[model samples]
Target chain A: MKELERVGLPTVHVCTIVPISQTVGANRIVPSVAIPHPLGDPTKPLEEEKAIRRRLLLKALEALQADIEEQTIFGN
Target chain B: MTYRVVHYINQFFAGIGGEERADYPPELREGVVGPGQALQAALGEEAVVVATLVCGDDYFAEHAEEAVDKIIGLLESYRPDALVAGPAFNAGRYGMACGALCDAVSKKLCIPVVTAMYPENPAVEIYRKDLYIVETSDSARGMRDAIPKMARLILKQLNGEPLGRPEEEGYIERGIRVNIFRDRIGAERAVDMLIKKLKGEDFATEYPMPSFDRVPPAPAIQNIREAKIALVTSGGIVPKGNPDRIEASSATKYGEYSIAGLENLTPETHETVHGGYDPTYANDDPDRVLPLDVARELEKEGAFGSLHDKYYATVGNGTPVAYAKKFGEEIAKKLKEADVDGVILTST
Candidate 1:
């Protein structure tokens, strides 16, 4: 992701483990769900799960459009 | 007689409890525990797991130094030839404990140690440069493959054998620039690489360019009074005498201190232990770096609902990025658990 960003490509490093990604120096971040299934949890109902996935995808798009300087974290 | 080795595992693997029991503290027991049993079997007659150390993820995060010290004392009494930590897979805290302990064991006890975890296990980034970490699948489904690989690497370390490339050995890259005497010398190697690059036929570069990765910045808080804010810093401020002994530089640990009843930081009560810069000013007025005094005043003025009683501190100078990330995650979780709605991170 860093290499991709370095070449003037807009990138958002998406993951459930924000701290780990930040430690690796990931520039743009979008916090997803937990590690196992990054977008949604199985414990949630099918519709709710879909909603979770949809929400994350929206956030990833939001992150790409956002501008940042220095170490910054995106997503709730 | 077999190679005596100590095993480390977390509470969940030990069958003690799950998240509810995550504050179970540290304990030492005879014989192998959950994952250790598999490790012992893989080790075969060449090695024996003499004892197992179990710790809760929360407990270790809360009291790292004390827990590590206690575990080390237990390990010293056993006098094991080597230490083997988990095939922790994707488990974050377990992987961290294993990585931190293995690193400590290697440095303090002067012994070889090995741990297995998923490549993204967080600990890999922190301790990999100082230890050998076998790469494994993200879940325990990869156990059968991981055990053998970890055992092979640990045995190699025990016997002081030479290791091949990371791909060849199934271990993650440690990012250390090793000086090896090449068969053809630097000029020949350079020419060979140049020709291969010009050919553009599956050429591999010996050096890769470095890139910096940063975050996009989380959204700012909307309401002040409704938001509970926690304070975090890499400024190395602590109670007088530096109780946690966080290193002046190259810190491996962090401290969480409560400011529940305190309104301002006094010179006699707090001081800066960081060695990278002048500490006189920070010592004279600890708030200059930590900003507890201003934070309290801001709270009274309703800039935020309430300040978290506890503030997390760790020395940033010379600290590895991995450790810094670990501290941040753990402290963030603690603050979140305390119902903190926002965080105020101050750095020196």
Candidate 2:
């Protein structure tokens, strides 16, 4: 992804862990969900889980398209 | 019998244009093109160039999963006996692409694959262990020598020949620990190495430390209301009884506790298990350190969408960075699944 971004393509990485993402030098990241279950909250109701996942996916799309000068953390 | 081979190269080598065209997606052409011609000539008649796949550096980087999947599909159709990626020299992205593609070909296609790049190219760090990554000069000027070396290595793999050491084969060492018998004993080798070092002569260390990859932060949040925030701490705050019994120092595990029903954390309900600092202040009102009080106020005011029902806790003090990394990964995956948008991380 670094190679792709270096060549002027937009990229976004979504992670539940911030430090690991930062350590890896990911310049565009959106923090969402958790590690074991990144897209859904198993404890939540089905509709709620779907809504939660949808919000994160939307955020990720925005993050991928945004321009960044340095490593920045994105959150809701 | 002629062996079918697929040649992989970057946009620059394909003459699709330079970095300006680096965003170009992967495309396949029947038979040789651009540098493929030179590569084909070097292969002789025993090998026949079957196809060439060209992708822009930026394109592959941004769409790695898709790019590799697409490339894999293209190659499966050709059913090539061997895969040859670029002698990428010192071009960072090109080197990465070649190394990554070759790795995929070797793993997924289960075919013999070969590539060449400068030893310094960052790709060598990740992909060298897969197979033959011949050493090349830093630019296209060394293309002459790089071609045949890669060709020879792949041909050897095809012939099922026993391989020699990297030094003899003109490839970089993968730094794997192989227990080959040596002429000198451990004590003697250590003494010999010490003398060489004292004399300022070159002597490679038996074990080289691995370097970590550094990454920049992601873009900042643009909208607060649309965000779903969460709280996380390395300050060792947990339920008063500490159900998980996480250690005070060098903690081996982390805890995820629900903050779903709380307006504020009470002294009776929460306390610190961290061994590095005084617990008096944090124990007085757990909210001071964990900040559930402040977060609740914001949640009521609609400062952000909503707080994640759970927050993670662990002790940062005295924990190994490696352990910390593992915890971070696991926690992040959980938070990601929960659809958290941002986090408020506190450290003592």
- Best model per TM-score: 2
Pairs that clash in candidate 1: A25-B213, A26-B213, A26-B214, A27-B213, A27-B214, A27-B215, A72-B215, A72-B217, A73-B217, A73-B218
lDDT of each: 0.75, 0.77
Interface RMSD measured for model 1: 17.1
- Which stretches of candidate 2 lie above 4 Å from their native place? A1-76, B119-122, B211-348
Error of 2 at B68 (Å): 2.7
Q: What is the interface RMSD of each candidate, in Å?
A: 17.1, 12.1
Q: How do the residues B193-236 of candidate 2 rate in per-residue lDDT, one tens digit apiece?
A: 99999999999777665555554444445666767776777778
Cα distance off (Å), candidate 1, residue B40: 1.6
* Residue B19 in candidate 2, Cα distance off native in Å: 2.4
Q: What DockQ, between 0 and 1, does each candidate earn?
A: 0.05, 0.07
